[model samples]
Target chain A: MRSVQIPISDETIRSLEVGEPVALSGVMITGRDAAHKWMVDTFIKKTRQPEGDDQQVYAALKPILAGGVIYHCGPVVAGLDTKDYRFVAAGPTTSSREEPYQGDVMRHFNVKGVIGKGGMGPKTLAACQEAPGAYLHAIGGAASLIAQSVKRVLGVHKLDFGVPEAMWVIEVQDFPVVVTMDAHGRSQHAVIEAQSKSALEKLLAA
Target chain B: MQDLTEPILELVRLTSTDLPADVEQALRQAVEREAPGSAARGALETILKNVALSRANSTPICQDTGTPLFYVRHPAGWSTRSLRAQIESAVAQATAHAYLRPNSVDSLSGKNSGNNLGGHYFPTIHFEEVEGEALVIELMLKGGGCENVGAQYSLPHSQLGAGRDLAGVRKVVLDAVHQAQGQGCAPGILGVAIGGDRGSSYYASKEALLRKLDEPNPDESLAALEARLTQEANQLGIGPMGFGGETTVLDAKITHLNRLPASYFVSVSYMCWAYRRRKMVWKDGQVSYS
Candidate 1:
């Protein structure tokens, strides 16, 4: 298994091959449906100016995301009352949900990789091809095991986005993932879909 | 009825943290079928480890502790009004205890309920009055990932040569499994409702998930269909997390309801491998969980 640290270089990211096991160890930001939509609508599309603390939030996020990983996760969190957030259970949410904004988010932020489940669509694969990035597939529902990899909680933003949807900056060690979509424009999900479609047709005929 | 709030809280904890034995067995079997060092096997290994750790540590098995859906069956005189409140209270406690994620959000306001308590639909409690003295409450944590891939089909459709027969049902069901292609988190369990109105069909399909993974359907025809669907779905090669390997679906459950003459709706509910569900039974003035 390959080990990946944060502030990964483009060359390092591009070197990741599809189906290879990777143990990601570093800082990553957790974001989901609401966070993705908020990022796209506010910063990428510039529909509205960053309101209140969002301007500062954006400035803080830019450097971290430049060569970092964005995890598609809505984790079950602990320490809500004390505001000392820790992930009790953190697993990948379905990545396909972010297809609409992932490509643009990657380009805009220079994100080196995405850690998620179920892989992604052509848009993200294309984004990986254009830049040095890969889409890593985490084990779905392996929440507690995955949470064990989180060494510490760095911080969080967007409390208004709900606990799960909040952008949590966490430091992780030996977080496991499979590269399902690579910088070479190969998407394991797409390949499997094509194969499954053929099998479905055969079953229907039979 | 006595206060079921505390009992319901325990139910939520068990459902969230403990992997049912049968589901765990199916996953173990799946791991054996995949080649050594394969991504599919590795995923299953990680899942199993997570399941064990969650149970031992009393943490949620999945981060998306999911929507807490309670199916309540009470004796004739038992009050549903009280049951609903108790269930909600328990759900809130579960969220606070970290057995459940804060899942409910105000659709219009774009705000979370924070405690997993939203409007009526949240902690969705469906109550039915039964003849027995025992009160049974079952909870299924329906995760959003699998819920998104659920499909409904109106039969006698022209597109796939699917008619309003069992054969057509097989075709459409296969189509759903194929389209899911590990997006719903294969190896998945499919709960299929063959006939009913749009609402009941979908409801019954999800209800079918409460059945044990290895239990045979009472209806012979439905049992056969269920077995065949599971077999054919696995053939799709949409293995664990869609990396394309041996197993896709661990089981397929089939249930049927009589429909009006005009409508032939078949609803499919896909459950991810986690498959969190548990029940609490109150009988002889004692409460027990399974």
Candidate 2:
């Protein structure tokens, strides 16, 4: 198992291999379907056309996102109204749901890592290789266990997207995940899916 | 109705925090089956540890506290309206207490109710009029991850070469499991319905999940099919969290519905290892939970 800190460098990400378990520390940003779409459509695609507040939004995120990890999660938070928010249960949501927007989000934000489960498609694998990022697979249902790694709730963005879909910036320590898709262009998910499909065929034949 | 609130709240809390014994046993066996130091074993170990921590700390088993489904069996004169109101109230309390995450969202506006209530059919309750004087309620927390992977198939599928027979049902069911891969959190359970229209078939499939994990269908044929499918699904190497190991499916419960001659539908509902379900019985003005 590899223990790495956040704001991870591209060289560190590139050196990670598929199936290597990792303990990620430092700060990361949470974003799921709504946040991903908002990032891609509002800030990324309109990068050149700085209209309205798009440029400002892009500028605000640039520093935080450069070489940072985007976690696909919708954490159950406590004390939202009292200005004190505690993570009740925070686990990785299915990554494939954001497959279309992830590649673009990674490249546009210079994101060095994507933390999620269920993995992504060929496009994401290729994007990780090109962007030199990695896809970290967190245990899907281990919500409370995962929340233990979150040391602090930094800030939040896009509250209009609702609680689960909102972007929560959090500080974590020893956050456990597996490198399912690394910057080296290998994906354990793709390999497992292919092997499982062949096994299904054999079962049907029998 | 006021008296019913506490039991319902307790039911919600227990369902959210405690891993049912049947499910825990199945997971323990799966852990033993996997090779030492394997990824699948590691994932299952983490899940078991999570279960223990959640139970001890009284936290939600999964972040998605899911759509709370209530199956109620009441005496003829009992009011379902009052029961629904009480259940909703209990759900809100559970949310405030952090036993349940606020899950209901406005589909049109994307606004969370913040109390796990208010959306249409949220905390869905199904009532059945029975002869018994006791009120029995079963609650299941169906997470979004497993719910998204559920599939319904009409027989005579050309792609699968499935006909309107038992073989066809087997083919499509296995196909759904394969498609789910690790997305639904494998080492999961399958609740299958064979027959009924599109809507009822899906309903029956989820209802099938209410059965005990260790129990078998009373019908001999369905019971055998359940065993066979469970075995074959594990053989697919889709193991726990799709890490690859000896156990992919922990249990499969099958139920059949009478359908019109024109329709033959097979619906499958997948439940993750965190299968949160519990029962509460109200008898003689006293409530007891299991």
Candidate 3:
């Protein structure tokens, strides 16, 4: 197992190998479907004009993503009325859904990694290579356990997107994941998909 | 009629936080099947520990608590309107209590309801009047990852030489598992409905998932098909989260409906490893849960 703190250096991220276990700590931000779209449209694509605290949200996230990781999650939180937010269940959402925006987001922000479940497509793998980043695969549906690693909910952005779609900044310790795709262009997900496809064909023939 | 909001709230809480004994047991067995220090075993171990933590702390097992699916079998003369109101009430309360996330979102407006109530169809409720004086409600919290990977196949699919028969059903099901990979949340239980129209096909497929994990279809042919499909799917080696290990599917439950002569459809609904589902019964002024 390897230990990775937030704002991970490119050298450290590049050294990480696919199929290796990792424990991520320090501060990171959560972004899911809506957050990704909003980021691309308002900032990267410049298709949608910045409005309603969009600039402020970006300002908050800019430094965090410069070398830090973005987690694909929409966590269940408590104390919204009081604004003392606490993440109750915060597991990784399926990353493939964000494939359209993930690569662009990484390039725009110089992000070091994307943490999520399942995996992403070739575009994301290419982005990882360009930015010296990686794709860390968290266990899908292991929410309560994963939340235990979250020591604090620093803040949140995009409340109108609902609890699951909102981007949350949090402090974590020892968040577990497997390095499915690495900067060196190796991808465990691609390997597994190919192997499974071959196995399926053989079974059908039998 | 007695108000059922409280019992339903409890049902939502338990279902969200705890895994059914059968599902948990299968996960335990799956863990042992993986090689030591393998990602598959590590994933299952984390899942097992998460269930315990969620149960003890009464937190949601998954951040996406998912849409609530309710199957209601009540006696005649009971008001479905009132029952629905009560269910919605309990669902909102659960959200406030953090047992459920505010999952409902507007399709066009790009807005969230901020409660689980997006519309009438948001928390899907299927009601049937049975010949009994009791009321029974079954709830399943099907997560979005598995739901997104669900699939339906038309009969006489020429690619695999599949035709309108049980053989075709097996082919499509295996195809779905391979396509789903880890995205369907492996060690998944497949709920398959064959022979219904497109809409009912999908509906029945999801409804079939409410069955106990190990329960088999009553029909001899269907039971045998279920067994064969389960084994073959695991053979594809898409273990937990597609990490690749000994187990891919924990169980498969199959059910069929009469189809029009022109149509033969097979719908497969994938349930994630969390497998959050539970039942509540109201009988003779007494309430019990299982």
Best by DockQ: 1
**How would you encode candidate 2's per-residue C-alpha lDDT over A1-206 as one tens digit per residue?**
67998898988999899888999999998999888877877777754454565466567677778999999999888887785888889988999999999999889889999998888999999999999899999998899899999999988776667778888889999999988898888988889899999999898877
- Every candidate's lDDT: 0.91, 0.89, 0.92
Q: How far in Å is the alpha carbon of A94 misplaced in model 3?
A: 0.5
Model 3: per-residue lDDT, tens digit, A78-173?
Answer: 999999999899999999999999999999999998999999999999999999899999988888889989999999888888888888999999
User: What CAPRI grade goes to candidate 3?
Assistant: high
In model 2, the runs with Cα more than 4 Å from the true position are A47-58
Question: Candidate 1 residues B1-290, lDDT tens each?
Answer: 68879988999999999999999999999999999988888888888999999999999999988888889988898888888888889988999999999999899998998889988899898999999789999999989999999999999877878999998999899999988888887899999999989999999999999999878999998899999998899889899988888899999999999999999988999999999999899998899999
Worst 10 residues of 2 chain A by lDDT: A46-55
Query: Which residue segments of model 1 deviate by more than 4 Å?
Result: none
Tell how far residue B206 is off in model 2, in angstroms.
0.7
Q: What TM-score does chain B get in every candidate?
A: 0.98, 0.98, 0.98
lDDT of 2 by residue, B132-249 (tens): 7788999999999999999999998988888999898999999999999999988899999999999999999999998998777999999999999999998889888887778989
